[model samples]
Target: MSQHTLLIEVGTEELPPKALKSLSQAFSQSIVNSLTAQGLDVGAVTSFAAPRRLAVSIAKVPSATPLNEVEMWGPPAHIAFDKDGEPTKAGIAFAQKNGVDINALSVANDGKIDKVFVQIKQGGDAVAALLAPIVEQALAELPIPKRMRWGAKRVEFVRPVHWLVMLHGDQIVDGQVMGLQSGRNSRGHRFHCNEAVPIATADNYAAALEAAYVLADYDARQQRIVSQVEACANQLGGIAQMAPSLLDEVTALVEWPVALAGKFESRFLAVPAEALISSMGEHQKYFHLTDTNGALLPYFITVANLESKDPAQVIDGNERVIRPRLSDAAFFFETDKKVSLESQRERLKNIVFQAKLGTIFDKTERVAKLAKSIAERVNGNAEKAERAGILCKSDLVTNMVGEFDTMQGIAGYYYALNDGEDNEVAQALNEQYLPRFAGDQLPQTQTGTLLALADRLDTLVGIFGIGQQPTGSKDPFALRRASLGVLRLLVEKQLPLDLRELLEAAIAQHAALPAADGLTDTVLQYMLDRFRAWYEDAQIAPEIFMAVSAKDLSQPLDIDNRVKAVQAFAQLPEADALAAANKRVANILAKLDQQPSQGVNTALLKDDAERALAEAITQQKSTIAPLFANSHYTEVLSSLAGMQSTVDTFFDQVMVMADDIAVRNNRLALLAELRALFLDVADISLLVRAKA
Candidate 1:
């Protein structure tokens, strides 16, 4: 076998900044997989992603794959031969299909019986002959959500393909890729080199690109951007908070990244820092700098694609462009503050929350009432919560929030503050949307927690009331997020709120026309179902959740407590025996027509084993009843675990179904009492299956 460095480059117009990294990585891995699948020698693959190209280089690859001997299945030996062992036409046809003589086939045991199989040595194709199609397949499989066709060519790609570089050692593995002929010429940075550079060998790809003033490696360019951004921010006596997404996007937009400091008017700082930061980071794609105390600085750092002769001109251009953006933000902020958020409440009537759900103002009214109820139940200020909810979405109509949509809730917070609302009320304006996505921060204040939970509950009930329950991933209204938000607030904040009562309150606030028949239960079940993924991530088995779910535990906080209790109980030494016994009791009860009249009569308790089990239950219930009342599920299970030996002994010694009807009924009642003890926390039968 011979080995050489293999380089593949797909040149294009500037790629999408957000998708460049994923595309490049996918392209590299796709090539590696294709080579490995063909039994070819593959080595460490390094990818290069610049604004204009995606390339991968392999340190070790073979010119051609080695010949392989593989078996080909044929008809069973018994079926292929006659009774005398003479070859039939089927045997000849099988050998002919494999291009082998009938006698060349051998009998091999395929585990169950012998079958006729042929072993053939097949040579591999040359790398040059295979690279073109593999490259084409790799491009065809790129994670491109949308593709465009440029020029008259009947080909589609993420961007227009300009050139390609496919080299094996010093030789060009010639083929057409994405309507471009393969070659060693790759264009450098548009502003720096602006000319095609010839790659002499596959091994010199990075060095050659760097010489042309292009940092082809994605990670190297990303690190360089970070270093420069931090240095510029340091010089300005602030730190640049480089968001990973923004950094990756900027890295994709530049070749030779040179971070330089720029500034806007200091007066713009009076505007909310969120507005200014969004203007710079979202609109201008610049990294904003903040001082040690977390105050916004007027300075920003912008990455230039090229090194300018003056460098000051580059800085001035970026600063000049940012000033207008910041000025617009300042104007929106000032204009928005002229009218208080309270006055904007009337505008919500013109906006629709959902077509059937009524106007936005209607939703706010419902959320206001529901939130106040929740606040009162949780010992928070009802009046303050209602006021905050009333004004929370008012920022949607504000000039500042309309201009900077990402700052909707934040602008409302500042506006509420300027309006002289209470501090918690003002904070709730923003806190309502605290967890905007996965793993985001939750509301820190009691008022915010109430508003977030109320708003989501209202939406869930209103939507599900209209029969728009989320179905099979088509959650256009983000119902899953709303559900998770409610669960998180209840569980993480340890709010002692009951979900059943909350859903009822929210459902009561819905318009009377929708006929919320079982809609409340539907919404609660959906919310509880979201708990499955949460507990699964915690390594709590599905049966544990089922155990808690079987009890109709609606309060997420309580449900979480019970789940933890069940999980802990499952590890007890008596768990398996008790769970199996619980399953047996359940089966026996399910098979009976009547439930053995609820309570065991003392006069009917004739068997000594049944009497002993009954006595143990009465004592354990006295201790566990208090524990279950206080939601001390773990302690209750621990106390009940002590009855396992007594339960097993009763089942072993006492015949539950004696010929006497009264004796059988009493035994049934005893078993029913035992089952109810475990059902206080969870359905132990579900635990049985989980342990299995």
Candidate 2:
């Protein structure tokens, strides 16, 4: 087979900047998958994405797929043929489907029985013939929610298609894609180079685009933008606050990025820095600068799509545009600060949290009570926690927050301080929404922790109470996030809070929940199940989680400690033997009509192995009971690991179902005692030790 480089490009109207990276990568991967599925061999695939294009350049692609001999297995010989070995309807059907004669069918044993098999030589299609349909399928499978039809073409796509480039080596691979004839000509940057840049070969795609003032590689373009922005910020004697999302969007927006520093009025700094940053970044798509002390600077950097002879005009225009945006933010902040945070509570009464759960104001009342209860239990300031909870959602109705939704908690923090509220209360107003996503920071203050847990608990209980719990992926209320947030707060904060107790407390606060049996257990289990994924992501084994889950523990901190302990214990030399011993004991105990009621009688220990095992269990029971109380599960399991040899000897030499009834029952009792020790931490029997 001969190999050649394959180049594919789809030129279109400006693509969405946020979705460009995903679209480009998907296009390249889909093309590679389609080719491989057709038995074509391909090498490294390079993806290119920009405002107006999505493309891929594949190296070492075969011109035509190799011929293949595929085996077609039909029904078993007994079913395909009659008793006299004559062809039946099944055999005739298989022959017709595979385009072979019924007499030519071969019978071979497929392990169990003979089956009719046919060897068909499948011919390969030319690469040129496969390109168009592969590209069409790839485009059709893009993650586009809504597609549009442009002009009178009757064709729908993410955007209007302008041109299609398809090349095999230096020759144009002729085909039609998106109602356009395939060509080697690719359009350049809209302003810098408006002419069509002809690509001579697949290898020259990136160079040709670069010559026409286009940075086709998404990663390279992003790096260029970052370097330019940082340089601009360096000259301004501050650091550029280039958020990842904003950086990617800016990279997708321009082909030739020119970073220029622009200034906003220093007076706007009086507004909350968060609101100012959100205004500039979200509204104008500009990157803000910050001083070394983490204070917002007056300067911002904006990336232009083209390189200009005089960059000062671009900077001046950006400054003019940002002044009004910053002013709007400053105005919203000033207006919101006039009305007290508490006064905003009245407006929330009209806003519904959930139609079945009542208004946002009603939720705050429930959360306020819950926060106070949690604070008392966690040794926090109850009054301050209650105050923070009551005002947590007040920012949702504020002018500043309404204008910038991302500043919901942050705006409340500023307003609470202005209202002369306690410092912790004000901080909790913002911290209530901390850890908004995974790996995000948790609440730092005790009151903040209380309010955060209370808020999530209220939403979870209320939503689940109405039977609107997250089903599959249709989590319109984000109940999964709330559940994970609750677990994270309790576990990562080391609060030692019982989730079942908190759910019960939360359920009591919901006055209007529909009567549903087991609501508390159902929600608690759902939240506990979320730990499986959390542990999986941390690289903990699935069986380790399963062992801990078998105990049906409700306290997250305790469960977390046990999981870590079990993970450590699984690595010990004695773990597999001990786990096996526990499993054997469990199987024996499960068969009994009733477990051994009496403790192991020392008089009935007839075997030396059984006596040694009984003594080991007796000594460890006293030592481990205190460890279990303190939740020192690692120490407990490690101490239990020491009894593995004695356990093995008893199981090896002793007959558990002895002829003497007293001896048999005593042995069962002894085994039960041993299993119970491990059960205090987790059901080690459920553990599957990893093989060396």
Please, what is the whole-model Cα lDDT of each candidate in the order they appear?
A: 0.90, 0.92
Model 2 lDDT at residue 132: 96
- Which runs of model 1 end up more than 4 angstroms from their true locations? 76-93, 101-103, 106-115, 513-515, 599-615, 644-664
TM-score of each: 0.92, 0.96
Clashing pairs in 1: none
Cα error, residue 408 of model 2, in Å, equals 0.5
The alpha-carbon deviation from the true structure for residue 294 of candidate 2, after best TM-score superposition, in angstroms, is 1.4
- Error (Å) of candidate 2 at residue 529 is 1.1
Error of 2 at 528 (Å): 0.8
TM-score of structure candidate 2: 0.96
Q: Which lDDT tens digits does candidate 2 get at residues 290-352?
A: 999999999999999998888898888888988888888988988888999899899999999
Model 1 score (lDDT): 0.90
Poorest 10 consecutive residues by lDDT, candidate 2: 683-692
